[model samples]
Target chain A: MKTKGSILTHKPSRRQVLAYGGATMLSTPFISRAWAAPVEINMLAWYGHGEPDIVSEFEAANNVKFKPKYYAGGDNMLGLIAQSPPGTYDVILSDGEFVQQLNAAGYIEELNAADYPFDDMLYGDFQKFPGHWKDGKLYSMMVRFGHLGVSYNKNAISAEEAMSYSCFWKPEVKGKVGHFDWHLPSLGMMSLYDGNGAGLWDLSGSQWKKVQATTLSLRPQVGGYFDYGGTFNSLKNGEMQAMCGIGDWITGVLEKDGAPVGSVVPKEGGIQWTESYCIGKGSEKAEIVKKFIQYMLSPAGQVKSAKMAAYPGFAITKSGRAKLIEVDRKEAKRTGQIDGMANDPITLVKEGRIHYRNIPVQQSLEDWNDFWSEYKNA
Target chain B: MPVSGKRTQSALVETTPKRLLSHLLTFKNAVRLPIIIWQALFFIAPLMFMVAMSFFIVRNYRMTEAFEMKNWLKMMGRDYFWDSYGLTIGLATLATLVVMTVAFPAAYTLAFKVSENTRRWAVFLLIIPFFTSYLVRIFSWYVILAESGVINAMLGYIGLGPYIMLNTKFGTIVGYMTLTLPLVIILQTLSLANIDRSLVEAAHNLGCRPWRTVFRIVLPLARTGLIIAAVFCFILSFGDFVSPYYLGGSKPPTLPILIVDTVKSGQQWPRAAVVAVVMMVTLFIVAFGGIAAAYRRRVR
Candidate 1:
């Protein structure tokens, strides 16, 4: 088995596993799934991406099983990939910007243009996104895109105030803004607030020191660094007023839980994160993997992905975006998270405020991390 | 096969290869074979690789086989790393002392003052918390101590100000004490219960006061158990990631937290491994060295 992340974060130790009681929960349901299918395709993807309906549909259609093991971040996914034998995983769902990194590291195979519904679905910018290609060979497929923006409980903080980077430092919002623990985008957002949003990937410059001071000054205001699963409760309980790293999904999921929270991209701009599907380099079931990717990006599959348990977000494909609009009205009432956020990814692409990170990492990742360590230690 | 006296003598003196093999092929050895093999393959083997990994060069996000001290040098050269070390030791020490102070009295009362019929029930009550999840118990401190939590809500009802107890060093200390108190009490109680009651009576007969008897007689007798309990608390609290990660905020980063960040965000596995190795070695020295010192003191 492949593993990654903080030793206990992704793949927990025996003691923690017992503490979480996740193994019993995760293992009990899969016994039947293991026996029913003769062919199994192992997938490493985000937690909510594998909606049961979508997996079961894919399973019945192909007379095969889709074994979805969840991961938290792109870095952890890469670690899992690096540790595994090439033939181990059939498919990977990861950040779109990681295609070049994966291809460079020889972790994934290039895709055929005919295999995907590029012309029928994807917008022009994402159709042949440079990150998804290497030397003109297609290496990955963009599935969804979201923003790294502030999300707040409107009762505690105004949406307008939340839409500015200053919301974190404002005296009014102090002691209530929870910083999401994922350090990379949190740093990027801070740099954007400092008007040096560009070159966030390389923050060894003078801008970094300024951002460092700003982050340290705001330390007394930060409630805690929250994980993905904890964000909803922290916001709903009013334990925090706003979070620096929430996206559409976090806000949407919170709304579903009847929390009065909304997400906003500040006027200073926000970081954009895009996810994609790719075939592993030595996948024994390349053909099956390709079929799975096709199904995932198809209109119905995209609908499932949009409404996946984690939260709602924009699909890269035109058909998928249309499906998101056509979902249940109760589902659409997610604090307006689905109202305008994913309406037009292309327009946001034109705005030039959105930033894509090079994954598994950028060239200046180590420096960026050192900068983050200063914020944390401070 | 049955053999003559000379052949038996020769086999006993210098066994043939077949005899040596047959001697080892017993049910007792066979029964223990899997456990030994498993220990060697899983535990000892991974530990050896971790130590070896601490020496390699990590270039271009992947470790290479070349010998390098860069990971060690980088880890050691930072004051930030040592800050985590200091916090880890401080948190563990304070936690141990708090738990020991509370547990010693509780264990003493249960052993001497409490009736025999009630002792088992008291011990069971002390252990009732363990039946719940350790994570749940640790997280309860967050639910009970946060600015908006139950404790502050009660204070607010009485016109007292809501205290900011969560995300502080004090909150972490409270969490560690709660987590470790049950174990300490159980260990100390077991030791206290095992002491012969006749010693206490003899000290009383010699005109010693009850408190003095406890201090002069019971404590010295229970010294070994107290040492064991303190060490257990220190090790558990020192290595814990959940308590500090949740409650310590970002103040002085804990050692385990730093190790996890380096591995997860920095992708510096070799460096992470080195930090882990250092922590393991330090704990090893503390645990074993403490045991040796305690044994020597007891002998004297």
Candidate 2:
């Protein structure tokens, strides 16, 4: 009689052959790893962090690939690094204020200030910027910079009225205001509006309470919190009369689309915004990151970055500035914000009117978020 | 030395182990082993790790070897933690109830009262929304429900003026209802279809009315399906982060969003893990208790 061993010895089953085939298919990726794709560098950044064509060309020239990721806020960036293993990121496009936080966690690599052309490559005091420097070593390079103020529809509110911070809580403008979702700068704007001399970064306990109360008070009339695209959509659709913390990027892009949006620096003051490029600590492709940064600091990169998706570049470098055909000076004058020609980062830092953002301690940041949540709960 | 004879004896002994291996790799076991491995690796392992992490305290953004009950202790003291937890459960239950109530009738119509062509078209329409991305769908609703969006614009046409709907609890509920409807309907339809038509005819022959037949005979048979559908709906709504984040507009926050807010600090993941454990435990207790009570009634 036929038995199991005799049958097995006679022929291998089709099922067995298929199982081995499936295993081989599953292992193909690992087996092919020795002949991997081109060199790839991952970048964590904000919206429109790079020009598509330029990025592609840079990849082609260096025989590498671009892997870009975006984050909404500085704290959000820190949160990503916190959750990931060390060396997961090769570079990050982050806010300058977060340099301290990055340095504290040893997330960013320290750079030699002498390696690059700082004087012509950066604006006044932007070269060896105090906020971005520690122990006489530069940790990051500032690329995009602006002030956090208000953006309003010209049809809904007068330009002069929008210039005053009180317009946010005024009865006539009630229920027409919107806020960006980022708490740090938005909270800073609130402090300035409330005339808190304690400043935005280090608020006194009483000022903190006052700020909380003000946020709560505004909640009833405030429309909703929004991101960059959401804020623009609301403005275009007439869903919001005004939004907080809109810069040239917000209004300039909308204006170019033929939407009548205007940005204003209120009477009290506005918080300054800065974006920096940081080399991640323990990056595997250190040389690629260096080359990318070097190319980005050049006029070719600066010009490309400024016009990256309607976020017009007001380049810091003299060479970068030479590439701009139009500064939109007339619109800047009308809006009462920064003009491309005259504004310098150093003067803004020296002036007490502008608040310098600080990297938040964990507990304090959590407290701030909780306070915002409470205000929303109201 | 007569080593050839000795080799044959040893080979015969080794064949015994080969027979065991062959028994283990039979067709049924071969297929099932992959599923067992997958569930163990993906589901059970992470859950175990999370539960283990919750028992430890997070310091300076990293977990320490030191054990602490402080996270558990602190969770009890926070009122919002409890509030967020309750809201998540309540909203999920609310959404599930609404879905079941609405979907059961629709499913009944589709399964019992419709022509084949009609059923096909209806199912197609139900599935059409899934063709688009969920985020896109949610954002589309954001536009339609805005203060100046389509709904208000319609109301404006009738001189009703504008009514705010976009960033409220009502908006969030509506979003969840819309998102979870298709899943609930499809599940209940499958359940309803499997119910023997003979039961309905028996009830009718016994002079039972349509409503009575449905309530007493058909639904009783479809009880398992109803439970499955409701459970799926509850989990989806309870763990939902998008609708509440975009439409809830800061009010009526849910537990998942709270978990995210807590974990967004990066160092506070252990704290978030504690919240997750509590949520899982509470849901498990409620679900199992309901099932047990149902089983007791059947036994009686």
Candidate 3:
């Protein structure tokens, strides 16, 4: 009796079957569309103290959210872009050379100049890429800029020795010199010693050979190759007598540790790298991203970022520079380091004590790579 | 009897497809699908992409659609790549051999000679180093090995001049030993734990000395574990980027450091990728060979 009753109710209602089918069709498309959100942006940058705040502020102000991805350095940033899908990021920060690379690869979109109104505010040199940009259309905007130079341990090396590029390769500095593990800067310095005169981008075949030979010659005098963190720690502990490092970090180290550290731009000058922010080509929200870039370049934004210890890309508005000076003085007074901001590029270059010029992107990268390889294996 | 046979046949016929479906639905088989998919997605796909990319020339920082062997050719011509490869392999091999040699004796003592409570503490001590970040450990070694660091500072107190060890191959070797030793000991101990204690006792009763008992009975039984541990130590020390980058001085840059510098400085991705693939393949071969050798020894 029970089996027969169950068989009688086994046939399903048409309305119930139709409702189930409709729900499946509706939910499948709805779920797929939910996975594709419109108001999200992916931002890739090297890790920095100010990045988290900037991202959060932008997200809140625009009523949109961003996922920030951080890489260790410029190379890693480029490697990630290479491996990732085209639209994986909406914004990316990289150095000048990589900006050119990205533009050439069509991985970046031409920034809308009309939307970003800070064109006149940038340093003249920052407006154009000597080799990579063409036809007066800019591919990237400068986010931050700084000079690369030597930092010395005040306890171990004399201030006079610290001022000269020759101190890096001195016999007494053997097992004490800490050069950047990077090839371009180290070999570029070597090129200067070989009489290429800091214009590493313009070195001829003979000069290039001389640079290579000089680097190999200096290998014995070299102590260790260091990245940002290691170089700073080694300098602080007096393990490294002298090192090739960024000017900003040197200033920061002195301010933090009150360690007697001095930086020099050297007689032959040094390389200046500009960290540029560009909109990714695959970004669906290019207009909004461009607006964010514009805001970053504004005086208010630039000053805010600069006060946090990052160098501003735009020429500091007179007021902004004054504010920066005030900040520096306050920092100096607190740390007891009297000459913290004296390595400003404008002053250094005006005094004829240091020189810096744009490095050709492709040639410089190739030269740097070649020099590094030889430097390591030699 | 005929009715019984017919009923059995009908039962067999009825359950044939159901039995096949149940076999397919077993827990082991159900889990295998996801594991296979994971392996393909995580390992096989990326490797295939890397190999394909290695054959292409990068133009303007983008791989061209055209296929070429220019990267491979350039790599072959470059002496630096070969030199780095040789140095990396040599250093890794030396470090692996040293680690195994030191770990075996230490593991033996911990396994057989120590009391149970002491053995637990010893194993705990072995793993304590791993609690710190790898970079911090490597940096700590610099403070220990540098000319003006603790060791030299102590030496100076005894009237000896500063001992320069930090940037030398010796410093790197010492650091590698510190890095790999703990792991080797832990793995070997786990392997040694499963050994039958009566065998060692029997060997001792048979008049074999302690050392002979270790080599003849204990080590052979734990051969598989030793090989696995050695493989780990070898791969780790061989492919180590941070240790050499921090501790190794100018003259002998290890392969990973060189690869990193090349890629970063020049945007020489192709050449860097080639070096990376070489290191990866070397590690794979060593890992597989070590396991195979252990398996052969075990079978014998």
Which structure among the candidates has the greatest lDDT?
A: 1
Scanning candidate 1 chain B in windows of ten residues, the lowest lDDT window is B291-300
A154-272: candidate 1 lDDT, tens digit per residue = 88778778878787877876767787777677877777787875566565546667777777787878867766745666676677778887677788777777788877777777777
For candidate 2, write residues B135-254 as lDDT tens digits. 788888877898878898899988996877766677777778878999888888878888899989999999999999998888888887778778778878887887877776545457
Candidate 1: residue A134 lDDT (0-100): 71
Model 3 per-residue lDDT tens digits across residues B15-98: 788787887789677789898999999999988777776776665545554467777787777888788788888999999999
Alpha-carbon runs more than 4 Å astray in model 1: A1-36, A51-54, A202-204, A329-346, A358-363, B1-45, B124-128, B140-142, B249-251, B298-300
Best by DockQ: 3
By lDDT, the better pick of 1 and 3 is: 1
In angstroms, what RMSD does candidate 1 have relative to the true structure? Answer: 12.6
Better of 2 and 3 by DockQ: 3
Q: lDDT of each structure?
A: 0.76, 0.74, 0.70
Candidate 3 scores an iRMS of 2.6
Q: Tell me the native contact fraction for each prediction.
A: 0.29, 0.32, 0.58
Ranking by TM-score: 1, 2, 3
Residue-level lDDT tens digits of model 2 in A1-378: 855577546776899989989999999977766456778788888767744754877876676777877777776788777667888889888887877788888898887677566878544667866468887878888776766677788887888888877777767666668777666777777778888632466677777778777777777778776667667777777777888766666877787778878775676777767778889999988778877887777777766666667465456676665544345435433333243433343344455556655544323776886666555445
Q: Could you tell me every candidate's TM-score relative to the true structure?
A: 0.84, 0.81, 0.78
Model 2, runs deviating above 4 Å: A1-38, A50-54, A82-87, A121-123, A172-176, A227-229, A284-288, A310-313, A325-351, A360-363, B1-36, B63-66, B198-209, B289-300
| Span of ten consecutive residues with least summed lDDT in model 2 chain A | A334-343
TM-score of 2: 0.81
